[model samples]
Target: MPMTSTPTPAMAKQTPKQPPTPTAKATKATPTRKRPKLCPPDVTDRRRRPAGRIAPEALAAERGSALEGLDWLGRPPEATASLLYRLLRLVARFIIFVVFRFRIRTSGQENIPAGGYFLVAAAHRGWMDPFLVMQALPSQPRCWFLGSAPSTFTSRWRERLIHRLGGLLPVWRGGVGIDQHVASARAVIANGAVFAQMPEGTVSGPAGLIGPFRTGWAVIALRVDAPIVPLAIAGTEELYLGRRMVSRVLPVTSARALAGLDHGAEMPPPGTREELDVARRMSDALAAIIGPVVESIHPRTVDPVEHPRRFRRRLTWLFLRPGRLDRDG
Candidate 1:
């Protein structure tokens, strides 16, 4: 028989009992810590962090820009016009200023530039738009306006006066005489004065609703590498072509208008989608100066608008051009 050994009292005393496992109820009762949200607790304040204060460097840059603008203004005109041009400009300025007593408020006039070539892409609200923009300037700088022919100077006397004054040049739409129109415009800028055109091609309204821009202005800007200044003319919608002559009959307050200039936005590569996109953007800038009057009357419809295939490529579009329509249906 094999000998059997029994454990000693000391060894038995060394063994320890295991602790009990937690029950399902106990585990479920424990609270879990949650991860914090990235955004602020108050949705209204939305900012995750405090607004950044303007840096000193930014302030210095602004001052430098202002100084540069002054230097530009002090520079000489690109080219001088004849004495006759000067006299005509002065007379027209006097008529608009002293006679009509047109009151205008302007913002961002500094963007007119110091020298060289630039074009004003004005939003046409009524016949007086060109006159309003021209007179709004602090200095009466001579500008050649591109007008629509057959319709611009309807009467013989009006035609003769405009021709003699050497201010208005006609641009025939529908591909008729477009080249000549462009050439004449080039000549004007070559002589140092600025050229202005109502890019909307027609009057939209006083409230600043702009229509499609004609490509002629964009082509000119690209060819000369000239900057295009966006100009918005407001408060002259009531002075439509029919009412312009008798505008003085209205209260002096009705003659008041506002024009705002947006800093020059350089033209992108010519003939590219960017060209059309930029022109549209400039139209939007011109609309801002018209104020909220028109908007209140015909509040913009929130419905979606359809656009052409070419326009779809624009990354900066708010949504198909505001007034675009579907190709079919």
Candidate 2:
């Protein structure tokens, strides 16, 4: 076996001085994007509009088609009162007074303006409330009603009958074609005929429990410079034979008075904050005036014993829309 030679320090080849292994340059981290914050349904954001309310532009587009075949707006109220209207009104009177035997007691007939046009703002409790009001008034100058087109024109016959009646100014709720409705109402009031409307907007709530009154009627009254007669109706909520209904007409509320203006003062321009303020004030005033009368006549709490089960469901079914009675209030 050969003995191995011990290698000297110099004999070991110098390790190659290679370039330091390149350290990976610290990679700049890419930032993750943040998601947008979502708001809850109940949260009212100033930047966003409330749901279910139509934007003004979309409402404008709908107005044209809404009033398209409603030629009655062009004619005066008297022109549309044909023979059919008179006969139908007579039949309605017979049904209300003779068939149903509803004893209508009225007061404040003196409060109604003698000659010029005015508005009758009432609480709508039943389907026959309008006819009851018509019966309460003098039959010479028929009152034109601002009726919901959807509710009033449910069938083709109803639409034709309403059109022939000549006293209905059909309005699309939820701000559809409101301009045309206001215009038609103004024309009706200007023609020396009374215009009537339910400020509650619909037949909701129990008798004497008036809903929040809408300001649309106030707006129309202001525009036409007419007085709003607050008419309180009770006992029409449940109709039956020998039902006694009372209609009381409160004092007249003039547009000037409602706007907080003195006689001979000009009204605020339409769509102005001042005009809206006036409308709200008028609505509140009318509600206050009519609420007490309603409550006095027909209290909110009913004694089940007094209102018997006899003909209750059947009578309610006869006058009210099926499954749509808004008694929840």
Candidate 3:
């Protein structure tokens, strides 16, 4: 055999490599894990949130007690003029006359209806303005006031005293207890008495400046079909002895007429856009009527230098509660 040789040791160990076969475990699909949904924090968690963030029902219930411990609104309209009311009015008048020596002057007394329900809308400048208006009006049908509960009832004694006097209809600010307030006001009007309110809502800046009027008065007047007797008070902003306080009653007008709506026309449902528009127009008309009167009596801007020297500075703080004496204007 021509050149046939024996294989080497390295050639015997060498072989061709091949791909491995696939198995069932390698072809299977992996499962996906689902995540949990997120949610808002609980309002009842007192430690984590503020106390004011309570439920609507809880808030209403809390605010409904604003007039609690007072029996004024529970009485019949005719019976609302209790003896305490007359006595308190007399005492207030005595203080105004003898203690303060304030000269009371009134104009357009004839504008006030002799015997009927009416609304007295006035610009509020000070705590004493309400008492001044009460003094100016006749005492027959007692006047009921829609007062801010927090401002009026600052203490237990004040709350008790005001409750005993029996003429205030407590209303909380920020729209709490609004329905009850409207109902009480309507009751006062239906009782054939005067309902006095400050259209500016709270004491605005010094005596002469009138703040923007709110629509509550206009809305209530329209709903009750009562005439509004605009009252412009002057000289109570800054108080001193021998001050001349004037209560001028403007012409009596109806909210419906002021809003340019037909007399006795049905009002849109409460809180509706149409109703709001009507109230706004009525409030604007009211402001137009009363603005000039107030400005004429009291200058728009008062200089501190022109203020009369108060011998006893405490006299200026007479109407303000002790708690508010230190507060700045």
Candidate 4:
């Protein structure tokens, strides 16, 4: 039996295989592309090519069209609303602030730049809130207000008046119109124009009560990198008593600067829900900052919460309205 066994091949002769290690070439990653700048159309227009084959008049028209681009506000012709527009603006201001004696208590008035696309926010109390909002500018930076459509404006004349007022961004409520609204806001902001909004939208329901503010302001501020200015209006309700309310230029942005908002943490990435949340927080923060200052100007009513400084009829012989007037005055 021992002689019959044949020798088997040696196990030592077989090679053990090793797993492959990755080489630098085999594991290379793809490079990333940079994002394009999100500048306004006006800025973009500076680089467009001129038309080569049009007649002089036609070329002029074509050239204007090409150069009138704005990242936001659509191409507007060089025309503005009629002179009647200016007169009406003058009359409106005269009636509300001057003849009526609606006093404006402005603080920190030096902060606002004379012009630029910035975001301005303030408390909402009445339909006249817009008037108050405008009258109180540090320097009159024409604002683009996001509002209902021209049809919603109802009155044709009023619609024309609004457009003439400058920067009235129209958005259709509850439908396709919001396109115009967002577009208008985006255009003005991209172009370095001012856009003021009552983040709370609409005249507030009543005094001492405010509705849930919409996130539109946050959206625009975040997307456009525009400065946000929080404002507080106290004597407005009182103005309705004897005259229309007049606005005042408060140093809100400056106040924020004085309050040190400028040096705070970098704002969250703009154009995200996070940006909106920041806007909400900002609204709350500004409200907190101004609440005390406002309280001192107009005390709240215990029986029913008050709205700013409301003046009422004095029972005195000379101050009564209508039939209550003394027959022998």
Candidate 5:
């Protein structure tokens, strides 16, 4: 009796190896719940939780975002949906006032993607193209509209508005300021926003053939290793019923995004002999999409574009740098 001992129930129940970690017990004891996604809006609306904690089943009855007034006009959506709507409407004002009267239609809108940053290039046909392209766009993958090249005539309010809407970028008017521009464009792309530019330089006006292709666009694309999307719009002059027919013409033309390859270092430098050759090929590629209409369609006739003071100042450093020659005795 003295030697006999009853086995303890606790000892019989335990048969483990190593000790458990502190976090292991905590994790095992707690149940994890998934978080709700707050990305872009969905195709369909889900019901709102009543009492701020609606059951999953209650989601069927909730209303989504509201669009009252012209609040939804802004482009380049903000973190908040309501804000995005407002920005979208703001961008639309240009179209409503100017482009709609021209009947500027947008064709090949299917070409524009729904999201992310890109390098958007359009053949400069008329001053009207930027307004038409920006306003009539079907989608803005988080638009960051770059303003026109520095012009002396731009109003302060207009400048402020362009920047406020995230539409401000400098463009070199002529010659080969390609490398310098690529630096500026790189900043935009790096920031995860779109960089929009007109490769045609100033408006085509009624005169001047579409001019030779500018290599700066290709250079920037290759430098950033970004896709170069060519935008071809026609009918600004042809469709201009002064201010009425702009609506019809707005929808015409085509847009193509050449996401082919990075075009990286493999591509020639802009303005170089090699670059010129490549740019010509790109121009031809765009021409194929636009066809004969562009050849015959004249630019919306307008006065020559003038550079603004601020732009001229910035460009002075890049463009007006005279070569300093050392005169030796």
Candidate 6:
């Protein structure tokens, strides 16, 4: 019973079990194919293209597009009449500085770029504010203004004269022809001229009080890729009364910041709530910058809190009527 049992005959017939066949050495996994890198549209072609080479059709299309859009007063004539322009500017400046006896204090003339497009905006309370802003810039770059159409174009002769000056753009209120005006501004700025607009849209508001700013300036600034300069041209409120006008061209703010806007965003139509909100934000930013300067210039006269509201209400009513708000004489 204690003896081990012998294997069966069938088991004996079977050969001693051999070690299990070793699996063929596992082959390393084949590497996966990598995706090709994507190139930018400009470099999509593998062949190196010559620099500045553009298709004739593309160039022609661009040229044709440029010629279209609302007609600007005219192409900037700075190069053809640089001297004459400067001379005329000087004479006009002299009249403003001497005859008007404006104080003409400026803060950031250096902020004005020597060339290229930019927007100079101010709290407009009178016709002279735009002119003062123009003269205040030490650079004195060729500038176009977005002025009220009815006021500036009162006569054909007046229109011709303003158009000849090379920076006069007329804007209609109550959202009429705004697209054309904005397009015109784009064209002027695209041509490398300075564009200036009174964010307040008119000169009827109280002095030193910033009224509700219009959205057109933001639209132009954003679309034109121009930096907005919040210029403070105070004291013009008393210009006719013999008080000196003090104006300062403040530091430049990116249009995006001033308007709280981004490039290429569809502009809300003029006078709409969305547009007004954008304008109000821009005005707030500008007011923050120029409020102190305005106060220092005309501390006793500034009643921003009460006066601007009343003026705006009156303006809202006038703006709703059939005729233009006649410009200050």
Assess candidate 6 and give its TM-score to the true structure: 0.60
lDDT of 6 at 5: 84
* Model 3 bad stretches (over 4 Å): 1-65, 68-72, 77-80, 299-308, 311-313, 319-329
Question: What lDDT tens digits, residue by residue, belong to model 5 across residues 1-329?
Answer: 47977779887678466786567344445767889866654534566533333321222123233211112223332322246546666766654455443344444555554433344434454445555656545434334443333331124475445445544453322342455556555655555545566555544444324444455565565556654444555544322223321211212211123323342436555457765655556556554543344543334332234512233223222211122111010
Tens digits of per-residue lDDT, candidate 4, 1-329, equal: 46765545664456456788776687567988989989898886787553233222343253343111122234541123346645666786786566554544455556666555454544554445555666555223355566433222434575555544454555432222233444555666555556666666544343434445555554555545555665555444333334322233444353234223466556566456665566676556555654544454343322233534334423111111223211111
Tell me, what's the RMSD of every candidate?
Answer: 21.8, 13.1, 14.3, 24.7, 26.2, 23.2
- lDDT (Cα, tens digit) per residue for candidate 1, span 118-222: 545444545566666665443334566776543443355865565555556664333333445556556656666666666566555334444555555645554
TM-scores of the candidates in the order shown: 0.48, 0.72, 0.71, 0.53, 0.49, 0.60
Task: State candidate 1's TM-score.
Answer: 0.48
TM-score of structure candidate 3: 0.71
lDDT of 2 by residue, 1-329 (tens): 99999877776666556899878899889999999788886674557542444333344365443442234455666623457777887898887788766678788888777534665545676677887677767775678887765455545687676676677776653444356666766676666667788888767666666778887778877887876677888776676666677778777778787667899888889878888899999888777778888888664323345654446555544644454323332
Per-residue lDDT of 126-223 in model 3, one digit per residue for the tens? Answer: 67787777766788787778876655655668867866666677764434435666677677777777777787776655566567888877777766
Per-model CA lDDT versus the true structure? 0.46, 0.68, 0.67, 0.47, 0.43, 0.58
Q: Which residues of candidate 2, in runs, are more than 4 Å off?
A: 1-74, 79-82, 299-310, 317-320, 324-329
Ordered by lDDT, highest first, the candidates read 2, 3, 6, 4, 1, 5
lDDT (tens digit, per residue) of candidate 6 on 42-132: 7786775434443323443543432222353445334123666677778977865666444455566787765455565556765566667
Regions of model 1 farther than 4 Å from truth: 1-82, 88-90, 138-141, 240-329
For candidate 3, give the lDDT of residue 32: 78
Better of 1 and 5 by lDDT: 1
lDDT of 2 at 27: 80
